[model samples]
Target: MRKVLWIILGCTIASIGVLILRHSHVVTGGTAGLSLSLSYALPLSFAVIFFLINIPFYLFSFFQMGWKFTATTIGSVSLLSLLTSLDHLLPSFTLPSLMGAVTGGLIAGLGLSILFMNGASLGGANILALFAQRKFGWDPGKVNFSFDFLVVLSSMYSIGFSKGIFSVMSIAITGFVISYFKQKIALHNQPTPASVTQPLDNAISK
Candidate 1:
């Protein structure tokens, strides 16, 4: 129950960041950014594009991470899509480029870290990152960053060089934040060392 709420919260936070970037005409990395880029050129909306792009990754998540993870990811992605789709209801304003990148990237990164902590993801590169982290001990954040960088770079033709550069910085900040969270989660789950003579000490006390 608590976990579900946390996932919802994460989704909301991520949606807000997406909204920020969208209005700023900036995009982050991953399929989220990819969808955003596509939305700029296509007549479709970001929500629709994002959900569609993630469909294939759901299969990847199910096969690599398991049904439970895949289910949670689907839900999270849906919730985020729904939330961001509501952008039409709000007053519109664009933030300065650097401000939007830094702010949106950080918020989205923290939200994503929470989701990853709870075994959920936004799919696409996120699924790959988590799978590699669990299966091969790769750093999920770095792997994620690499994937994001490529996707964002590819979108440069649409978003232009200046926005693409800012997008890179945003994803870099996001990746660093995610790496920090992964390290902290790793340390938190490490077993504490027991005294070597604890059995003898217990026997003496008894």
Candidate 2:
């Protein structure tokens, strides 16, 4: 129940971030960016594209990350897709390009951070990133950043050079947030030395 709530919250936040980027006509990395790029040439919506693109990754998630994580991720991605589609119903507004880039990036980063901490993700590169972290002890953020850079670069022709650059910035911010917050969460969850030794000390005193 708690996990479900956190996943919903995380997906909601992440969808809002995606909405900001879409409203500003910007892109980010991962499957979301890929979907955005495809949306230009295809007749389908970004939400549909995003959801379809992630389908292949589920096999990998299931085999590598286990059923529980894979199920949670599917739920998270579905909610995000639905929410992002609903965003189109809202009244449109404009934002300055620079502000959009920074704010969108930060917002998206926060959303991704929450999803990651909760053991769910937006799928695509996120699944790969987590798998790499678990199998190879790699830093998921750096791995994600590397892939995101390539994804954003590939989008240059579609979104124009300037907007693609902004996409890169957004992904960079997202990667930083993932790395920083993961570390913080890890440290927070780590058993303290005092706690570990308390049992021994109490036994000795007794």
Candidate 3:
């Protein structure tokens, strides 16, 4: 129940943050950025673009991250898509580029953190990052940042150079936020020493 609540909150927050970025005419990274970029060129909505882009990654997560993670992620992504669509029904307003960058970054960071901590994800590069962290001992946050960097660079053509720069600011802040929590979670999950988990007698004998 707690996990479900957290995942829902995460999706809501993420969808709002993405909407803010879109309305500001800016972009971020990962599948979100890709979806945003494509949405600008294509007539399709961001929700549809986002959901479609993540389909391939869903398969990756299912095979590498297991069914439970993939299932939760699929649910999270689907809900986020639905929530972001609601933005169209609301009073339309555009945030300034700078304000959108900072605010969206913070909100996205928080939402991504919540989703990750709860064992859910937005798929795409997120799935790859987590897999690398577990299987290769890499820093998931840095991996995410690297992927986001490439995505932003590739998307500069679509969003224009100036907006891409702002997008960089957004992703950088989001990366920092994710790295902070990733470190804490990694430390928390480290193996406990025998002396800590074992009885004194057992420890001394061992």
Candidate 4:
């Protein structure tokens, strides 16, 4: 219950970040970035592109991460798609390119961190990142950054070079946040030597 709410909140925050980037005519990386780039060329909405692009990744998630995680990711992605589409209904505004880049990246980083902690994701490269981590112990951040570079590079054609550069900055900030927090969480989950010994000592005393 609590976890579900956290996931929803995370998705909402990340969607808002994407909305900000869209309004500023900037892009990020990952599957969402690919969807944004496509939306520029096609008449489709970002929501439609995002949802469709993620469909194939669900199979990877299900096979590698299990049904529960896959279902949760589906829910998160769907919610983000709906929210991003509905952003059209919100009052229109704009931000300076640099500000938009930094703000969007920070907000997205925080949101994605929350989703990851809750065992949900926005799919696409996220699925691959997790799979690589599980199978080969590759850092998810590095995997995501590699995919992000390709997606953002492709966006240069749609969004132009200047915006693409900003997009890179945004994703770099986001990836750093994800990596830093993920590592910290991993360390926190490890049993300290004192903690291990304390339990054994307690058992011996009993």
Stretch of 10 with least lDDT, candidate 2: 197-206
TM-scores of all candidate predictions against the true structure: 0.84, 0.83, 0.83, 0.82
Tens-digit lDDT track for model 3 on 45-93? 9879877888888888888888989999989878987898788698978
All-Cα superposition RMSD per candidate = 7.3, 6.5, 6.5, 6.3
How high is the lDDT of residue 28 in model 3? 69
Best candidate (score: lDDT) = 1
Q: Residues 93-177, candidate 2, lDDT per residue (tens digit)?
A: 9776677777877887777777776678878998888777666657778888898898888899977999888878878887887
Candidate 4 residue-wise lDDT at 35: 88
Clashes of each: 0, 0, 0, 0
Provide the global lDDT of candidate 3 against the true structure: 0.79
83: Cα error in model 4, Å: 1.9
Error (Å) of candidate 3 at residue 163 is: 0.4
Which clashing pairs does model 2 show? none
lDDT of each: 0.80, 0.76, 0.79, 0.77
Alpha-carbon error at 179 in model 2, in Å? 0.9
Per-residue accuracy of model 4 over 1-206 as CA lDDT, tens digit each: 86788788999999888887777777778897798789988999977987788878988788878898899988888788788879868898888889888888888877887777666788998777666655676676778778988999998987789998998888887887778666532332233465443332232233
